[model samples]
Target chain A: MTLLKNIWEWDKRNFERLRRFQLPHRFKQIGFALFLVAFLALLAFRFVNNDATVIKTSLKYILLIGLLIISVSKEKIEDERIVQLRQQSYQVAFVVGVLYSILILPLVNYMADVIFKKESLGFEVNSWEVLFIMLLMQWFIFRMMRKKCS
Target chain B: MKNTLKVERAILNLTQDELAKEIGVSRQTINSIETNRYVPSTVLALKLSELFKKPVNDFFTLEEND
Candidate 1:
């Protein structure tokens, strides 16, 4: 019982410490701007230098990092309800992201192969893509839930 | 959980926004709690109790479903 209690206390303390590290509300806007610039740059680069895989990958990472910043930033009103909704959104997004990567993507690849009458096109879902999907889903669900609650 | 937050606020003639400001929460949070869409944490409950000069039990009650 004492060990369990100590562990609970440690967990609670770390959770509070993590909360303190959240970025201010204004960071969300900065994150959005970064994401937009990276996305547009990626598109322009793709047209200009189609074979620039390294630069394209770097741009994608920048976009994902921007999203991560947005996800970690605090809301204007960072109350208990908002925290709860954020946690719920993360949970839902994780489950959906895993399912999409493991099931939906594979199924779509299979369908495409059958339609084209070709061998496996070596289509694979990367971790970055899964992270992007999860972040997008989290943002969408969080906004929807906030709207509903309001 | 069911709460008499709406009733207490009404009795105090306080708008949701006003009460929310007093409790350091967003207006939507007060609205959600009153509408049964959200259950506040104990800290928030105690803050409300303190502000309203009532025991937590007076304003909050557990529903059978809860």
Candidate 2:
């Protein structure tokens, strides 16, 4: 019985360590994910020397799809605090997305005029900006409203 | 977030998860309510009160903003 109790306590400690879902846990996962992306991006940039456009574009598209999948987890949100945070986050993201569009509009037109020589889908790189803004807004709302609800 | 949930659960000695199952919510939701993380809607408040064998007012009290 004593041995069993000690084993149970050890197992509980292990579980807690593995399943730590606080802010630092989420941040660590995100940091690791970003590092993986940067490593892959560097590899893609280095390896495909010839016919750069085809391979680089494909790599960018892959990253685009990956980012979309990660951000699309918005569909699975279930917590009320998270939902409340999302509501305010969306409000800010909308404003920030619009502002981002405005800031990039001139650059986009210039890129079209000088580089691509016409309108193109280069603006899709705004995915990270949108995700960042959304997360920032969510955090802001969570911080602002968390106390009130409590 | 203020609720007569403590009184209701106390009468039966039902755990938060058991009460949540009875009301068709996740345990986290019941915990949230008990800890004042979220306030239930009028319908849900009424349901809880009914389950607790109490009046809605007895189960839920309103503050100025809430």
Chain B TM for prediction 1: 0.95
User: Candidate 2 residues B1-66, lDDT tens each?
Assistant: 367677778888999888877876657667778877677767667768778887888767777776
**Candidate 1's residue-wise lDDT over B1-66, tens digit each?**
889998999999999999999999999999999998998999999999999999999999988987
Q: Which ranges of candidate 2 are over 4 A from the true structure?
A: A1-51, A74-82, A95-150, B64-66
Q: After superposition, how far is residue A120 of candidate 2 from its true place, in Å?
A: 21
Docking class of 1: medium
Predictions in order: lDDT: 0.91, 0.62
lDDT (0-100) at residue A136 of candidate 1? Answer: 90
Computed on C-alpha atoms, the DockQ of candidate 1 is 0.74
Q: Candidate 1 on A1-150: residue-level lDDT in tens?
A: 999999999999999998678999999999999899998998899679568888788899999989988899999989999999999999999999999998988888899889997788455888888999999999889999999987
**TM-scores for all candidates?**
0.88, 0.49
Q: What docking grade applies to model 2?
A: incorrect
RMSD of 2: 13.7
lDDT of 2 by residue, A39-137 (tens): 498586786676666656665555544443333243222454455554665676677667766666556656777875675654455665555555544
10 residues in a row with least lDDT, candidate 1 chain A: A117-126
